[model samples]
Target: MQQQTNYSNELSGKIALVTGGTKGAGKAIAERLKAAGATVVITARNKPDQADPDLYFVPADLSKRGAADSVAKATLERYGRLDILINNLGGSETPAGGFAALNDEHWESTISTNLLAPVRLDRAFLPQMLENGNGVIIHIASIQGRLPLYDATLPYAAAKAGLINYSKGLAKEVTSKGLRVLTVSPGWIKTENVKYFLERIARSSNSSIEEAQQSVIAALGGIPYGRPAEPEEVAELVGFLASPRAKYLSGSEFVIDGGTIPTI
Candidate 1:
């Protein structure tokens, strides 16, 4: 917490809103923003494992449409200004198999979580950022959006693809007004969510944890780095992008997947 405060000019004195920031990449981004002298605020459906007294935490399930508006309103009420927005709240709640395995509820839930949640939050917060004529918004996307895992996470991939396209379009629509929108598409991250996926795979198949992990890597077409990315690595990118140093960088898709993803 104490070490994350150095900034390269773009983040000083800015107030930021980080969705799903209580843990994982979200937490890493918040801590990094704080280190850069930004007033960082986070939100989640529940109190996270590593919550601290100094950090701002807003509890709300972002899957609900009203939750986005409420969280944005709360940020204004609490901080009076919003300068950076990291839309990091996204996931695939449904299990794997194929299209036949997913029901209507599962598909809807995936789209809502991975696509619509940030869209709603952006709607709630962007007007002010636009009115101010300067701000940064980063969306955490996935490489699966382009390389679809049709057997297990097709819907998740589709929604993430929509998110990437949406981020680009949103950037185009808002950059003139001074809001810079971008997407960070990570290949595979070794977060708690990845651990959960590994555990599930281990349970369903007759394989050890290590084997399940290898299976996932194989499914991703084998990461050239041979390992998943650390959350802090992604956070570092978010930190840089949110700063003034990256002022010219907008409507871009950044892939930090250890040289994974076969295509450009």
Candidate 2:
């Protein structure tokens, strides 16, 4: 069982912008930030009917160029300043297949959503943050960057790998100036999408759900934890990274995978 820890409401005076905060890991991150007392604004392509009225929402398709600028403008307009930018939006929309199975469009879309989206948003927002002389940017990347599955996720893996590099470079560039840029790479997380994917695999292959799950795990080499992580677990890491408690921890990439990565 996981013990609940008080997050100190340390983010009391901060304002945060979390991309893709409607569901999954992004939603968890947004809620955690709110619990820590930050005024949060969220961006999404689709708005939910029961969206929290306390939180500001900006609608923009991040894969589209200039969307980030629009979101930044709206966030600043609503709050006048941004203290935290959480790049929590990404996925592999590519169809299943090896190298020859994917085309130019698939690659471009994957790269745009996974890598370019955050880069563009950061470009529009980070200048203001840097000028303010203090801020934190957290990029939510994936473990596929280091351990590529290669089948249908090559593009996503490659893009996340680029993001890791980009985050590192940006961190080094601005750390001395009092800005903190960090990356968090999560392993297989138990999201609704994954559950649906597994169900489809089970139905199509006429295999038990357990078997399909094991297959997914096998593809990852093996998960020592024996299962995927909860969205909240990933969110807790985001919370810590965004807190003042982690002040000296800029530019680091924290991998939260229950020892699954098999790396030092």
Candidate 3:
């Protein structure tokens, strides 16, 4: 336990910001970074029902205009320095009937949330990081970015794909300046949103929850490891990437999909 505690404190003295950190993977990532001894700040549209005492919660819908600037201003006023930034805000609200079902608003929202929010946040906070001469920025993308699901998350996938490309290019531009940038692409994490989605599918089909989950998995090819990732699993990767352990790593996309992608 002592060794574990020491290991988790890897980010000591760092100030980190996690967007959409109210729940699900964002919450997990925030907690993980906090456990790693970073002063973690979380931003979402609303505060969580039960907030973590260790984290500073900032309320802002990052998809909206000027939200990124607002968060950066608040964070800078409070912490004075930003050592890490995690772009974990992303989702798809478009209905699952494929391209014809999607419209301009859906595409625009997805792109704004998944791609442009990070771009704006990076623009806002990166100056502080660059000034400090050290920092890490992680974009929590989706495996759908690479292996897209046309019927459901097409826009989300495309946005994430754009994010991945942008992250790589940004890393190339900034790594020489001592700021590290990377992307994490996770496949089907069993977050609260996914669980609720599975429940809804079960209710609609009059089937068991397990059946609904398996059906969704089958749609994504298959999880050779036989389960969706837990939020903490993804958080672990983010924590490492944010810490000095991964100091040598930058500009890469780490895919955590339980071997579901089926390619090198």
Candidate 4:
């Protein structure tokens, strides 16, 4: 049960860009920002399947070299300024196996999507934020960065680890400059893709979906909260962090993992 209220326009007069905003956590974040009263722009390799007239769409593959620059240019040309940037485009399509199963291309693509894409986009957009003297940049990392499931997402984990480190250093460099940089690392979130993956695992392992889910929990040493997080739950935290209420909060890694990592 959640309470409804007449929302304040906390993000009124602001502009936000969310990469891979067509689906999953990215979509939730984009919607949350819009509800907060920001003019939101979304970028993906293709336009969304459904029409969303409220959001401006930019089509670009963030893994490519100049895509970030093109997106930044278009956004600035249309809106003249950007106040928030959410780097939420990341995944591992690498085949499930250990290090020997991964080739150079696998490693390169994973690193490009998970780490370099955000770096390039941040570099492209940070100058304007610096000139304006205030902004927020969020890197959507994963618990895999710290507690890796090597049998499947080794490259993704390695890349996210790099992203976490890069985000921290960038935050330290820019917090004094009026731009707040932060990282949000989520655990197993209940998204469409995750549901489909669990189904596939259930079929392949000749197990029930419940068993398949448990297998994942066991692999992560267990999620004490008892289930995965909803994408909207992750989005809520992002919304607060992007708000003026979190003004003094920067250069931090916020983990929304339901106590999945056993250690402090």
Candidate 5:
């Protein structure tokens, strides 16, 4: 008979914070860490649709000024320390068009959410992590950072590219101090928002959902795996990185895009 290993207590005494944890990938990560026995704290602008007593939720708009410090304060005050920080809050609301369509507000908002929010949160939490000589910081970026789609998500892609660069620099500075700073760049994730996007595309183009999905894949230069990743898949990667198993892993970017980006 084959033996199955139990990992329910891997992070038994750790404290973790996940931004944008109200839903989608963030939610999955929070749940994953919790399942690994971590005391998980989640933050977002709105309350979760369904609350789990096990997860601590903080309501805040990280894009706004002062929000990052506020969230860090709340988390530290409640838990005393954080062992894992997942900067997962990010999105793009710019309308479809080329570079000419984006305004300063669009650029600023995209940069603030995708890049600056994590920067601020990291600043707020680094002192304690450095003091303890250990912690993990994961920045959730996008494959668009490299494979940019100019007509739709130019600002978002630019911000994510900046985030990727920043993560690398941060890892270089902090890796010796025992804090692991890494970036996870995903291509197309089939989250609730993405599902809605596909529905909208299908409705607008008068095509089936599968056709809309194919159109998006074609627009992305094709996802070689033929499908977007599930939220749990990304969460699993995050869980492993936050665990002791990845102790030697640092200063790296893990791309979870199902081979979406063609270049090596």
Candidate 6:
């Protein structure tokens, strides 16, 4: 028989910070990093329903001005250094109804949350990471960046597209200076919130949850894999990318959309 490889300590001495880590894919990513032996720090607007003792939690709303600086200060004061940064706190609260329904406030708020927050956080932490001569920055973007749903998530898609472009530019500037920057764009993730969303769709359409899910998938031009991705699956990709195994990877957007994008 072959011997089993013990890969649990890949990030034994690394310290990672994940934004919006109280729930959904953010929580999953934080957990994954922790399981891989990194000291994980998570920040969100609210406390997690069930706390994990191993992970450090900081309450913050990144959309507010100066919030990024506060979070960076708190983390650095505690850990002294950051090895990995995951910019994952993003969402749109704007009402549906296409461009005409939106106003300056809607666009500004959406842009601030989805684009500016990450930029501010990155600025706050970059000095230390650059001084250390090593670090990894991963931006959690969305597939909507490229394939946007105009009726509901236009601003969000635009912001994520900006993030993707910014991530690439940052990578070009930092990759030679000992920092790695990458983007992960995922499509419909089947999280707890998404389950509720599906339920609502089911009720509204007078259909089963499965049918509602299929309808949503169909609206996305179909996920070739036949389902939305699980939070853990996306977490797994982030874990690998943040590990030594992907040392050669940088300045690229990794799409975990299950082929929802029709064109290459």
Q: Model 3 segments beyond 4 Å from truth?
A: 1-5, 199-211
lDDT (C-alpha) at residue 215 in model 1: 85
**Backbone-clash count (model 3):** 0
Collision pairs in model 1: 4-35, 5-35, 5-36, 6-35, 10-243, 10-244
Global lDDT of each model? Answer: 0.87, 0.89, 0.90, 0.92, 0.92, 0.92
**Clashing pairs counted in every model:** 6, 0, 0, 0, 0, 0
User: What is the Cα root-mean-square deviation between model 5 and the actual structure?
Assistant: 2.1
Question: Which candidate model has the greater TM-score, 1 or 4?
Answer: 1
TM-score of 4: 0.94
Q: Candidate 1 — number of clashing residue pairs? A: 6
Tell how far residue 4 is off in model 6, in angstroms.
5.3
Q: Which tens-of-lDDT digit does each residue in 70-117 have in candidate 5?
A: 999999999999999999999887766578878999999999999999
> lDDT tens string, model 3, 1-264?
455435767888999999989988999999999998899999999898797889999999889889999999999999898999999999876666679978999999989999999999999998888988889999999999889988667999999999999999999999999999999999999877886777656765678999988878888899999988999999999998898989899999999999999888
> What is the model-wide C-alpha lDDT for candidate 6?
0.92
Off by over 4 Å in 6: 1-4, 195-212
Q: Candidate 4: RMSD over Cα atoms?
A: 2.8
For residues 56-147, could you state the per-residue lDDT of candidate 2 as single tens digits? 88888999998998999898887888999999999886765579878999999999999999999999988898899999999999999898
Q: In model 3, what is the error at residue 213, expressed in angstroms? A: 2.4
Better of 1 and 6 by lDDT: 6
Error of model 5, residue 237, in angstroms: 0.6
For residues 47-132, what per-residue lDDT tens digits would candidate 1 score against the true structure? 87876775789998988879998998889998877998999998876766677878999989889888999999999987888788
Error in Å for residue 17 of model 1: 0.9
Cα RMSD (angstroms) for every candidate in the order listed: 3.5, 3.1, 2.5, 2.8, 2.1, 2.2
Best by TM-score: 1
User: How well does each candidate superpose onto the true structure, as a TM-score?
Assistant: 0.95, 0.94, 0.94, 0.94, 0.94, 0.93
